[model samples]
Target: MHLSDHDLRQFDDAYLQTLTSAQARALLGKALADLKAARERLGQNPSNSSRPPSTRLPWEGVGGQETPAGEPEVPAVSGDVAAVADTPGAAAEPEETADPRPRRQGSRRPLSGAPPGRRPGTPGHSRTQHLPVDAEQSHRPTCCAGCGQALTDAHASRAHNARYEIELIQPGVGATGLLLHQTKHTYYECACDCGHWTQAQPGRAQAEVEWTVALTEWHLAGPLLVAFICALSQRMRLSRARVREFLSDWLGLELSTATINQCLHEAGRAVAPVVEAELYAAVRNVELRYADETSWKEHGRLRWLWVFTCATATLFVVGKRSVEVVRQVLGETFNGWLMSDGFWAYRDLDQRLRCLAHLIRKAQALEDGLEPAAQRFGIEILTVIATVMAAVYDARGAPPPAGALRARHAPMLNALLNECLRQRDAPHEKTRALARELLNDWDTFWVVLDHPELPLTNNEAERALRHWVIARRIGMGTRTAQGTRAFAHLASVIETCRKRAVSPWPYLAEVVRQRRQGLQAPPLPSPAS
Candidate 1:
């Protein structure tokens, strides 16, 4: 049998896979390393391998002079002055001369009233100038009040002086403003054997004030970094090295690829504790909280980012997408309404408020190409439930009477529930059977109708997770588990601030500053505030 190149390659791949597990892993690791190295080299010298060689012209001649392509000729210069002199009315024309001395171009003569010995356009030569004021002339006040006598050094005894004042007048928008400051010093003089001398002890010098390392860290890790990484990795789709180059060029900061990775790791670690506390608080809220999960990666390993958001706070957790993680984060005994999609992991949670939006979508699919009666019935039930929810939501501060609303929608909801049960028992296909399994959680699905405050869907959590999803597409994934944790923490804090209508950058700056100063955490302003 003859094999093509593709077939041969496939056969080779199969043969390689048949090796011992350890050997296979080693081979795969080596291959991955090689690919990574190749990518790095390509990023460093993108155009080097593709450039063409340059060509040069050859010179050869009888007199060792360069020859023209087709023919060689003598160079000529015209002495046009004699031609013009022999012409009629030539003397009437203006005389011209080429001095050939290097003439200065673009030089401007100094303007009148220019500063002494200063050239035109020279630095500090033009525009309004500021004259220095002597300290004695500027600071001396023009007033005398001590015993209504002219004040002087002799009249004002330094021994009995209580304080000295210094007033600074600084330029403002239109005029100068006075800045009154005080300097208190005690006068002391000791009588020496030969002569008298005076000495004044100085106060302790205050330390220079500047941003702390922690504050610098917060600014570096906040939205600016998040936006940069997202734009480079996701939006621009650049490799890590390219991203680093762009960041360095634009931010005026030097960061190695490894250091960038490490900063992300450290940022994750810094926010983990706060994230855990916020997550607990969000889960413990009695009012309904929306929950959702989306795929993420850490060091190229498949992971998930779980979002749990209430009206007041939003929390993110990064881990394996499983029921265990959900239970671990939200706790097994979580009794308050848990609003989520039809994911089976959430089945174990009691009082689950299954997202009706998802259910309506499924029902719409089921009704397509169905018998008229079944389609009408499904549509009617969906409409009734939607109308009830709409009325509840529209009532705002005054929610519709739950008992009355339930009474009106109960019959249609019950009929829909019965239809779901019937379909589950006798599904048309394997896919339909899975749909039936989701329908089996019907009781939990309609629980949202009973409580107006409980959201009909996990849209809040999903919206909160959008930033992470975008970051994932950009940065690919976190390089480590700790980095993932830090991302979750920062994302949670940022989203929480957003939900509360507070600016995240300034808030994060303040939090880092106050925390370092051993100050209490300021209460986050309300959404209205």
Candidate 2:
């Protein structure tokens, strides 16, 4: 029954008009009330006897059947309908409900069939067959035994069964022994010249070397010496005896502190080249470098372990704290910027970037509890310095526009320098005077602003060197200059790998393996070989 376009339009209009604003609104309100009642009932008795009212509209009356008017008639239900319906305060049923939890599936059923015997295509089944011998069948020979004639069944029943047993012992401090048993039976043939014998070897035994390689590799990797032993004895505040006891109980290996030290030294030597190569590559690539030196004891004498680092790498050099040592580590011809605090040794380095953060700390201490005059002066100068440094950082990776930067910051810079000079010449306290002397290097300090990428603080380098400081406190510093160098090399590589998100152990292992196999000399920078 396809309706004409005109008829379809008229039908839609009539249907829409039937649901007039007020009538439609009333229907909705009644639906909401019904939904609320249903929800209250469900809440009171979740396992209710009432068949839930259908959300679907009822079918229009067909033929002569009269249609129920206004609301749809609900069907009767059995059991606890009244219990569910008694709750009036329950909330309305939601138009849409989502299950809050996931449902679990039932366990799988077992496969059902006859227990299978060896069949042609079945797994672990073979077609080849062997027949078993029975004592009664074997005794049924019908000849005489002396002349190799068949013997009577009654004479063949005299053969006796044989059995053997052996004991296996596990040798250790707490030894245990296991008994192994074997049984065999042999039949004597009527003919004396021929008899069949069968014997089974002991169950397959494991080769002694099965675990040897893995154990050797584990020890060679220095897990005990480097990680457990050294970390416990040196870093964890454990006594030497306690450390030894832990090794014996946990690893079944006993060692003195001196032996642990020797293993560490050997491991460091084995991995030194890989570390050195990484440090050299990192230093060569970074454009800005931070360097600092801290006191270290070597062979009972005072020395220094100088650390240098950038975004990509960390390198350490051990020597006496002299300007010459710094100059040597950082080649004279090298032209990149070096960040450090106001150490006079670094003063001669043409491209030094003084740490303004250190100066700020000193100024902050001086202005504490002071009059506005000093405080104001200190604040203004620090603010100007910070602003200029920020501008430099903002312009990093590119040259700042000619007069656009310095011209904008010039007035603030002049004002701060003039105030600093005035404070320096004034009759002030000793601390303030010393601060003034430090600030007098404003020309060199503020030069950092001209280079956008160079940081105003040497914090990066100091942070890179922090681990050494902690290690020195823990282990009382390296014992010799060579030991110091080894520490620097290994630490440099390990930290560099960490920064690059590479695992150091695998890299070190490969490098050591290649060196040991004599497949390469100096495992550092071989591109092809």
Candidate 3:
């Protein structure tokens, strides 16, 4: 769709609403042409569009049947094409039956799929059964729970079902002291017997300083240690002072803030290497890596809290928002698709999917503003992208959009970009600034479509950063350099455990347990391990 210079000039915010009747006709003509072109180009879908996955309609695939991948079950048609084909005089573009591909559908499921919900040979894995049982009581129903029928002897006279019952133990602090005796033997050099004596390995133990490490003193067992850490961080979101008060009041134990700080420091030290290794392993080989950064205050200095995440792990780093930090996290050569916003640090990276949500939000700002030209541009951009996304949803995981449809959409996209470039020097600051920004990072807007696995948005990384953002806003950011490092490590471990479906408390408690006993910290948990 082409706009004449006169038509384009009418896009000026002040000129549009006051246009004469003749100018109105010209503008309408241009808009109609653009809209007509837009109707032909359909490639957007929730998978490829700026529209989020959460916004997907539940009825998308209502009438559709599940077909095996790469083999869409198309209904065979038995009818006439020649009549309509011949009647269309222009180019004889064929008229055919509706696309036989199954329509996209959505559903509400607590879990994504309907699995057996238990493994083979698994015995009674319900929630009540999962926790340790303290007591069990059996009671025959004296009266029906619903109808109040008297049936104290119903089981004796009629069909009855036996049900197992489990009662949970009450919540109470259990403190246990552990005495771990470590013994090492050293052998002397070989003599006439001709057997050489090997030296014993050195003990990793050190004096149990008051603040040696979290759970490092062995004064607390695994359950208590895990409970304490969970109370301090995840469950209660409590400060050290609060944790002290909680233990003092409930558990009848006194813990100083300094002691609590030492515990966290020790926990951080024990878990740092293991967590870092797992983070790298988890994110390194993933199909898509989402990266994001936000403001972090470290020792009263403004810094960046960066998060790199994949499906199986999340790694956090707090430091300067610089290329060096990205390099440190991602290494020099990453071949996987990296999804991120259009940050200058991410520029020139290979295999990157720019966050469409960021661009769409910018367009939304324009859509809401008063400038007619800018508003129209923003609205059209949103429409075209949403249209393309709808088409993508219908693709049902088919290969990328074909050349013909891509070609049709190409001009429409070019027109928008051209319009942006044309208005780069517009008197309207918003229009000019947006145009300049789009022009500056133009390539990122469309590069990911070639790789179906690359995400269209960096929402994963953004969501990963959200928890810390809330915490930081509440003045929970680190106050010391060491504390900052510890926080990043702990956050990384917590997030990675969640991603891997392992309980952080159990794994962390084990790490601390090993550390306190002069043993090495355990590796990341797996079934085989």
Candidate 4:
């Protein structure tokens, strides 16, 4: 919306001093009228206002802003601004937008092509011979299908022709702890006492890799290499029993579960330093970052698993929840924007975006069960927020060209803040807590208004922690400090690789390969790099 010519003349910083009393009164009155009209038209729907339709409150009805179709109007109080509900007969609706994407219709159902019964075709991978079986056994029509006649041992009396059949046996999921003896070759000795040496090797290992509760060394081939893959959970959640099961089923090697645990710890020790350096480096140079911590267990003692994520890399650490841990991850000086919940450790950032989504949740919670005044206050604050959000959304979420949003909406935001600040000292504990959060982080929350493009949420960091959360649920956390280190490095690599669209297994293989060879672990995955 552009200012009127009269208002523009009055709006000039130095020119405002020359305006006469009558002219100033006329201009101010017109501006108030325009502001009132704008306010009335607001909340017509989610398209024009930041207020999600879900928070419309007990005060809205069809095509309504704050009152039901026939209910008597109430003044909508958002701070000092009182918006009389749009009258029932007064038509108010957001301007319709033309979306190019096709609108979906009805509930989604599964495609109706294939029947539910078993398919007529063979199952997947039934024909492909991806892995070579170690040993092969063949029979020449061992028994006749029609007569059940036992075939002679191979060529009985040199039969002219014989029918032959072949089949391949491969390992699959089976009884846990089942051990399959690796196929071997029996070397034959010369009867003549001649000196001859021959041997068979399935593969070669550069170093000794074993299944241990703590990783002593990372082996580069066979189960040793894949053990890193399992420890890092590239293929599955890392549980010693599960790792043992996987090794037996996939590599056909029976391994003690304790060794699986050791491999896991070794993996952490192997790459922790390499991962730590890269993570520290990545966060400092990143454009935008998110930091969060979730409960973690180290040998059953509670520890914090922290994550610092950006668009390209994710760094995770397991340590105590203190200023030191934050410094350990992000250091004393970071140039990029930090988005986080109002955790004190992150408050040191010079540039930060406080998560508005958390405040919104608190508001929603207030509305859910708080006293009438608090509920109304929460809704009012939400309304002001929705106003700014709706305006930004209308702009296709482009960051406003400098000072535009602040100039237009900062007053409204301040008004909302004033109410929260007042409530911060209210008698009720929940009410006081909610209000205090807003008051303490007032400046941080409003920063989002200045850069509408910046997310008003720290969901990125929250989301990064989910990988560890699920793993924690399954494995119940790590047992040793090294185990925690391994978990953190593996998680960091896994998340970073995912962000870069680089699979973790191959990168992990390189890390395991290099670390075992007394070389530095591979750097974090970066597709562009």
Q: Give the Cα error of residue 479 in candidate 3, in Å.
A: 0.8
Deviation (Å) of 515 in candidate 1:
7.1
Q: Could you give candidate 4's per-residue lDDT for residues 1-529 as a string of tens digits?
A: 3366664665775766788999778767766656644543453343233344444655666444455467787654663233334345335646757655444355235345556666778564322323333553232333434344444443232222221112112245773532233222222211111222222112122343332332222221233344444543533675677766766577555456654555555666666766767767887787788888878988779998888988888898888888898777777776878898877887777888887777776665555442577678768867876886687675554555787877888679778878877887885455788788777777788776666777777889877877567778677888777567667776777778778887776666566656654666666766645
TM-score of 3: 0.59
Can you give the TM-score per candidate against the true fold? 0.51, 0.51, 0.59, 0.59
- lDDT of every model, 2 decimals: 0.55, 0.55, 0.63, 0.62
* Per-residue error (Å), model 4, residue 37: 40
lDDT of 3 by residue, 275-372 (tens): 66767767777777899998899767899999999877899989998999888888788777788877788875777777777777767666655557
C-alpha positional error of residue 80 in candidate 3 after TM-score superposition, expressed in Å: 76
Q: For model 2, how does the per-residue alpha-carbon lDDT over 381-488 read when each residue is reduced to its tens digit? A: 567767877788777756767656767777887877677767776533424564475575666677755666557777787777666677676567777655665566
lDDT of 3 at 150: 48
Model 4 CA lDDT for position 278: 79
Q: Please give the ranking of all candidate structures by lDDT, highest first, separated by commas.
A: 3, 4, 1, 2
Candidate 3 lDDT trough over 10 residues, lowest sum:
183-192
Worst 10-residue lDDT window for candidate 2 reads 44-53
Q: Write the per-residue lDDT of candidate 1 for residues 100-159, one digit (tens) a residue.
A: 444445433333443567577667623232223223211221123323323334322334
